[model samples]
Target: MKPTEQIESTLDHVNMYSTPSDLKITDIRFTDIYGAPMHCSLMKIYTNSELVGFGEVRDAASKTYALMVKDRILGENPCNIDKIFRRIKQFGWHGRQSGGVCGIEVALWDIAGKAYGIPVYQMLGGKFRDKIRMYCDTDIDPHLSGVEAGQRVKQRLEKGYTLVKFDLGIGLLADVEGALCAPLGFLDQMKAYPPEVLFHSRATDEASRALRNKVYDLHNIAHPFTGIRITEKGLDYLEQYAAEVRSAVGYHVPLAIDHIGHIGVEDCIKLAQRLDKYTFAWLEDLVPWQYTDQYVHISRACQTPICTGEDIYLKENFLPLLQSRGVSVIHPDILTCGGILECKKIGDLAQDYEVAMAIHMAESPIACMAAVHTAAATENFLALEFHSEDVPWWSDLVCGLPHPIVQQGYIAVPDTPGLGIKALNDDVIAEHIHPGIPGQWEATEAWNNEWSHDRLWS
Candidate 1:
């Protein structure tokens, strides 16, 4: 073939939507959505080509995390995702701190996908599955009994969810006498406070600062350090709860449990032993993700599978748990665990150690779709979490996908360009915009000039 003919053929197939080589990032802006059950900050990275990529900060995380690094990425090509990710990743740390870096990385991928005219999963070396399995996370009223909880699980099953999770911890025993034995004032401090009081207590006044510090001190106490113990009577009640839930849901489906409270490892082991007969999918976050030794201890003590890692940040930090064979399942929240590619890498690494991977997602559709892409590309994938099944407007926040994203407990991997979202539903979003966060994707010129020497070494 002649060179001229080859050039002409290439031109025929050129993407009219984007000039990948010339796609420079113009700005980064955010809109916070409330009552997706939690406040989720949705990020949009605009490009010179007029294409916008969607990403999301972890639920309840501040948008400032993403805004702080805007200057570092301006004028850079969004297609160079890895190079850009390396530049900003240093700014991210574990937990919600990583939300900024992770969210931006996902947006970059979204742009790259649009530029290349393919789905994000295709760019991640193609997909391993056509549809991503979803696990419904149902949090019933804590005052409800185990039987009621089981009924909730039954509802999820009726909706076609093969895998389901529920909250099963000391929170259930909060009102029950003789259920929990803790240090003086600990239970009182942990009790739920009114929303107005809790919000006002975050003020900068001296009194508010002292009160906030006191609450933090109590909450930050490591699991083992807390002198909370569950008595035999408490154990019996919890066991009965599990029994009723299991009986209602039946043994055919996989049932997972979470939020077992801030109790120590001994209590976790006792509860795990007691509930082993019901055969739970896994006992999640028994202690904390940072306590690799505690997870190892719990895994060894119980027949039930142990799981953790939603609060974990990068894949490197997961090394301790993976190396020690601490947990049977590694649950990475896409937003917290360094976004789409990083979660896929975590899943790949977990597969090396024969560990299953279930994602922990409780954010907007932006983050949900990011997890869906990551799950589609990962080989050790289990199920992605669906936390907003009850939120009627949850799936309406974005367009270009099915009205009900989770059809029969699974989301079909989208083949459309970018994160499969054509555009954000401004009307639906307007209705749910977080009243406290003042603007809706307003111009962020202030962040454009905020500069710092980001280098870590001399």
Candidate 2:
């Protein structure tokens, strides 16, 4: 068969009205892939044809759109990917229609991959490699001393993680109550030119210097790649901290940092330029993603890689950054960037600009495995971030894997089918969920509302 013909044949005939009359939409379930919620809808297409497919609505509100799409997909052939996406978008009038449709499209693809006996990556194009390099977070408890933090880094390296990220944001140690920005603190902090700089115990320059060295020393232990995450803090010390880190690690090791806690891109560029001596790996999130032009300016000003995108939710968010060549690396949080399929799309887009890709992760193994598969399939993937290195039982959450997920500083991608990791560890879920927060999303009617075509184009 010809390639185009094969592609067309791969999709079974799809019609909105054809149905065996036995199947019905049975259940809907969702998992947070990157802080945003994605869903899986199980449709019993026949008395015996129990075909389960997955879908997503980019965020919580998307569930409402999913509800709408479900009404349309009731008896239709689930094999028509393009038709389904077009219909969903057509009916979904609100702008950002792509998000909801893209998500459901993902689940459809998952179902299609399973139905056709192939991985989603194979259907997209083909796999590039078998394993992905990972950047593991060095987890630290509140108020941990430099010595204590160093121990955490050692443990991650010993476990075979090649790269590590540490948090240095002043907000981590700031006394919110006493902060001038208290109550509406983040806003006030943003207004302050040189934000207040404070550590867990308010360490002085000497103490901060000593502590920085202790943490830096861990870089050369078993593996040398290391990075740090600092909140937007006193700009005065930005250069000093960069110098301190460089002096401690020498020139061979790379030092990177993140600007969480609402810092502006201009300020981030200033800080990055100040820290030029250290040859920092990347200065992250100088400004929120909406400011693409600012990101471009920051990238131009600093030789250090300008990387952002963790907060970016999909391909559209990545295009502005890519088209401008704003950053050398594109960081997409697997959970936020529409899980595996969406993130890979972002990575592939970044690869076009010769930009490296890294992930921002904060979830469990379910999302990690999805990320691994996507990262495995892409050509320009740099590393996947593991944020649970400090959680003692983090690895025990998932079961029945062919090998340990992370090995010798990298994660071995699973060649198996359908996300390749089981989500059935009850004990692990119970142990990890925040005590006050409940698990299993409670259905909220708040998201449902009548839609008027404001954002949508005809």
Candidate 3:
């Protein structure tokens, strides 16, 4: 339980990496493939040895996010995972940008697992559960008729998801009076954005407000600044949708709600209190997790459980929230939040505070496998997220997985080495590459030469 145990492991732990301390990272390259919700990227770290390791960056992020760390990790022993993580952890930050370090960490662990002939969970510690319980997520059209909503609940029930989440955003109030200030004020900024982001932007006008509207750049937006207020009338309208969904799903299942929009803490608290009758699994990301005080206020004010941390990076950043009991549950995205061991570390820390840990995942199979390993090892883990249950090709993204990747709402913890995925189906990836993005993975030789001194502390 000491910090040394996490960063430094004993020889008795797994004994897989002991034999291959000589394997060094020869090259690191990535492939971009389209996935549910957004385009996803992954790291393919080639070592001096033939055993390769694969890791995924969070969905909707750039592949270059991981490639930026190539200079730091090159020539390092891939098997010395924690030591390599320490050398490059300085390059990581608190959001999706941290994907670089996370991708590298997962890959290093994978390589070590393969080199040492063990599974990742064995290296982490030992398993707590044989299978990880998955919570399924899907979007809703608030305008659906009663019959339609009921039909949806029945369909999802047939699919065998025990825990469910629906998008509970301001869009539910679109046709109501004075419900939304500007519904489509910002439209798909992912396409309109420039090549690079600035530390300071001069877009204080009413027009350059997509970030304020919470339509884009979700990684950086602070919720309080949005000034998006919901009137009591709007609240009542939103509550109608909640009541309908709750009635359909019933209390027996853990029906969670999320994406309430960029509103102030006061509105968030009011809504949480108002919706207390429904008894949600958790109300997620009322704002970013950085506002620990507001989170504590919301946590104390409501009967419904509060959840956050899909955008948080490492265990150190989550400690403040855990110490303050700011939220009842810590939800981390596996690819964005420092991969397998780091998430296990966060889960362990949360256990100390009696806060439950659930993962926030929306990527290809590679990242989900990593999450499965972490969730399997963490005793206090509640659920791992499933965002692409509706995407038809999601399972085919990776080959050699058991058919029906998730069976009856649970994923069997794979017993094979590394993440247990045999390989990415190159043809499936080829079919799904987003337009204008590079379609090939082998052309990243140029990235190997792209280097700079990015060390932050002197």
Candidate 4:
């Protein structure tokens, strides 16, 4: 389609924003999914009309992620969203879709939006909200008391974040031994052990139930829309944990739960059914996207909203879910779901059904910025998750940005052209560089053992 042809699909596209300027990919950046901090790179895209756009590329921790990125986006037209993704997928065949191809595709759209001199949402369909409401996770230190968690909420409000969520299902079922048994370092261990062994080693019900109450107590004091991210252990004792939390906090605050890599849709439905009395924000990732029909059924049955798609790649991946109306909200991780442009499209589709959107974010500030921009443009955005609360150094990654994207718990839309945030490359390099992973600007040797057995498992 020509630049002026007015092409529109559920797919990612750059519609005219602020008079049509010829758009081209002028730059790229990337982020690493699994390691400390994050990794990213900037690339430049050029167009026949002499317009240039900047793009970003990122990946979760994988051996050949950087090489995989190069394989996909080196010469592709950053403006062509679908074509770029197709190219990335071809190179990403072996890896499936965790981060490599997905990250590069994201940066390309960021570049496209920048090239067009518009916020990504404007290209998607323009935005509905001036500021996107955000919910920060509640304070959870093995050391902190419920009062301390409540104090943190006061502090969070002072910092400007309006909403809060926390790990609610920690130690559940203290009466039952080994009730909560989440694998330690499941990210690294999952690479070594099969799923069954990992499950066997995880927490038991009693312990899981105990920890969950601790988290629930913290949730009890959290303000309304105080969200909860439940671990797999928590989900295991769904009936017990949900009942406890609802009773402890009362129904005034909205309850929410994330799958956290545990419990399929069946379990999600069961949990929702068990807690039907409380007003829930949503049931996140009841199952993976492949179980669309199951998700639909769960949504139909549960009083709680059904949400999924944190790891899904783009709008196309989410359309069937939306069309089925299985989910009440579409949860798109700005990094995983093809970045800002794709996320905006996902939100737009959700808007068609009057379904809301809640962004799933857990990366560094870079990904958060992309999310804020996209969320600013998305009308149906219910809330965006800021996963940086525990990490003090997260926001420093983008210290030079024009204004603080987040204030008083709401993120103001960036008025600048493109993604409207600059990468602190020098700081990024100083903090994130590791041996063989890409020295400075180049991809490094294959990463075989980046993760060691160090951090405690979940």
Candidate 5:
């Protein structure tokens, strides 16, 4: 073929199929992935070109977060991701409220990488490590026998996991009566709902059944609100629970603890003191991450390392915690921590304070892989979480990998373009869409229009 004909043929193909460069934010659609009970929706940005960028909303947040950003980036080039992020970043708020902006950011990076033909990490300044270490979020079965707990520990060690986390909350004492204080009316409110109720804790059947008999917002009810206190007997039983698990799992491995219910700093100090013998990797979210002083108190009071930050948004928000040395370790869920670049910034900020960082992940492989990229790029990263270790199909959600989704407790960062996924298998994804939502990737015509009085200052 002549050069002129070849050039014509290329131009014809560009018109025939939307070229990656001609892309604009033409459409966005979403659906939930049900395994973890997360509102796992995807934001797909359509361009004038053939390519589409995919991003996942953090779990348990509404799809509206992503939908609201549609008006801001509708005609913008996704390749200019930093500019696009700045335009929409103001809309993001603290915690889950920032889900939409964060989700859109992930999709933008996805689109930008696909357009430039590179990996997301390279966009953020290459990587620090070839593979990222991981900690499997395992729970000790309060109902399991001592032998069973030991077996579970052995299983993790055999599987090559160097780090593991477990719950050390009032939920463990749910089966033990007179442990968790509650209002009589609230206790009655809990009795009204059975284990199958929508408000139940999905973490465990034991926690569900145990907490079901407690007050309102069983696990989330704050200590200040409930005025719950552990009696001497209650404290004894709680320590016993910790001791049994520690005896089984042993102290050599890095054992982290979380979901400690909503107990305040004082009681948190006591609980951390009781379990200090076990040397937890960190005592996580003993109270919410918002209270900087409380974190400083908890950090000083407890011999065990203090940690939080799963719901924290952006690096700027994380500054107070790091600057104050509120906690010894920083944990940020990448989904809400300002996507890849912002999360890397959070880690870098923590590094200056000599604080280590960890990633909290609960979404599907899309978000996990995104976390993997950020984790690989950060130096102080301790471990990225694998929240759905029990679900075999979770890894099957995406394809085109050089290795298994995880190997020997580390995920090898792939050297592929655009999040390193060749293509997501649509048929496989359709099979696993959240059961509560009937529509799978349906057209998002309802959110096509936007409304706002969005502005910060003149």
Candidate 6:
């Protein structure tokens, strides 16, 4: 070949971005954004090269979860994703506790994709579909009647969501007489505090923390053990609500139900059977996810599909649910289920059991793109949950994606490398910083030297 042609060929093989082999972790930082419906902590893993990868802790989780492990990964190559994940996975547990290890794992994939100049899905294997179907989660005002709730959900259908979900349970029956039959003070306790304060919020003060802890004690009681039961009056009220919703949206659209409150297994079965006439997409989290036997009983007793696992941490934990066919659909939030690769593994495992997979995403745009990549790669994938469709600035948090990211009930998977995010919208992010913990990607220098023995075995 000619000298000029040889020079051009050598340049073609060069990556102008960064030297992938030499990339090392330099620092980690985070910024918290509140009221994109829930508080979310966004993290960035910096490397020696100019590349930075974005990740998000699960909604309502603390960034301290990620920071505590910074020293374990300092100076390690970000491209060694699985090795780093194995090194750090021992720190993660179920639910929001897994947020740190999972978020960091996502950042590693983002870095790996940028280094290889390919999309995350391509690295996973390849795309199964170019666009992912989205299921809108509509949480209307609790004061609204069932008819009013139906009208609210109908608005989402008009906005182009083919699949939808709504909250329906004993919580809605708090005001109605003879609707619920729990212990003497249990009913009063639920009525005294709003569900947000009782379940969602991170306590800011001593009094609030005590109140939250008290509520948590009551709320954490297992379903069968809670002594909470729905009365026939409650069943009638809930049934009527479902009828109104089904009538408003018509039977054509796929409608799902969630947050049925902490009622017992018998109450769960009763409610599921009562709502069977409405033909819901699924009865989600009817009982705690750990009670596989209860789930099996509920599934066997009802026509509506049973779904759970949004708070489950890893693939191994999901096996019993899948193996027993406890639920028809396995819904896993990528942020809670050990990040992109682990979510894909869960989907693959579910596929082996012949159950479908739907992702449960409630975090920021960073995690959304991580889910998008995973959904595109999984063969048994179903729709993904979009919790912030009503948040105007939700789409403004990230760049390099289409405006109004969810177009007519589906998100077009991006071909761009590294979760398809060019950069975060600093201005938009700054406007929504958490009021209690205000900052924008401040240096986490304290976490740099937090060393300890993390090994699980002798």
Best-fitting candidate, measured by TM-score?
Answer: 6
User: What would the per-residue lDDT of candidate 4 be over residues 24-129, giving only the tens digit for each residue?
Assistant: 3333333232232333343333444444444334433342443445533444566687776654553432112445565555556566665555666676666677
lDDT (C-alpha) at residue 357 in model 1: 98
What TM-score would you give candidate 3 relative to the actual structure?
A: 0.87
Tens-digit lDDT string for candidate 6 (262-290): 88898899889999888899989988899
Candidate 2 deviant stretches above 4 angstroms: 1-26, 30-106, 139-151, 172-255, 430-458
- RMSD in Å for all candidates: 2.3, 11.2, 6.5, 11.5, 5.3, 2.2
> Which residue pairs come into collision in candidate 2?
33-335, 34-335, 34-336, 54-107, 160-409, 162-409, 168-229, 169-230, 169-231, 181-185
Q: What is the overall TM-score of model 1 with all chains considered together?
A: 0.95
TM-score of candidate 5 to 2 decimals: 0.88
- The local lDDT score (0 to 100) that residue 387 gets in candidate 4 is 63
Q: Stretches of candidate 5 above 4 Å error?
A: 1-22, 145-147, 185-220
The sequence of per-residue lDDT tens digits that candidate 3 reaches over residues 227-249 is 56788888876777778777776
lDDT of each: 0.88, 0.55, 0.79, 0.56, 0.76, 0.90
lDDT of 2 by residue, 1-458 (tens): 99999877755532112242333333344432221111221111211244455444433233444555455554455556556555555544322333445445555555555455556666657778777777776545535554555566556666776666665444443533332122344334333422112112224578766654554343222101112223344544444544544454455544457633444444455567766666766767666666788888888887888888876655776899899988898887654565466677788888888999987655555556657777778889888877655555556656656445566767766644445543344565454433223444344333234344434556
The TM-score values for the models, in the order shown, are 0.95, 0.67, 0.87, 0.66, 0.88, 0.96
Among all windows of ten consecutive residues in candidate 2, which has the lowest summed lDDT? 35-44
**Poorest 10 consecutive residues by lDDT, candidate 4:** 219-228
Given candidate 2, what's the lDDT at residue 238?
41
Better of 2 and 4 by lDDT: 4
- Candidate 1 Cα errors over 4 Å, as ranges: 1-14, 192-214
Clashing pairs in 6: none
Q: Rank the candidates by TM-score, best first.
A: 6, 1, 5, 3, 2, 4
Q: Estimate candidate 6's alpha-carbon lDDT, on a 0 to 1 scale.
A: 0.90
Local error of candidate 6 at residue 301 (angstroms): 0.7
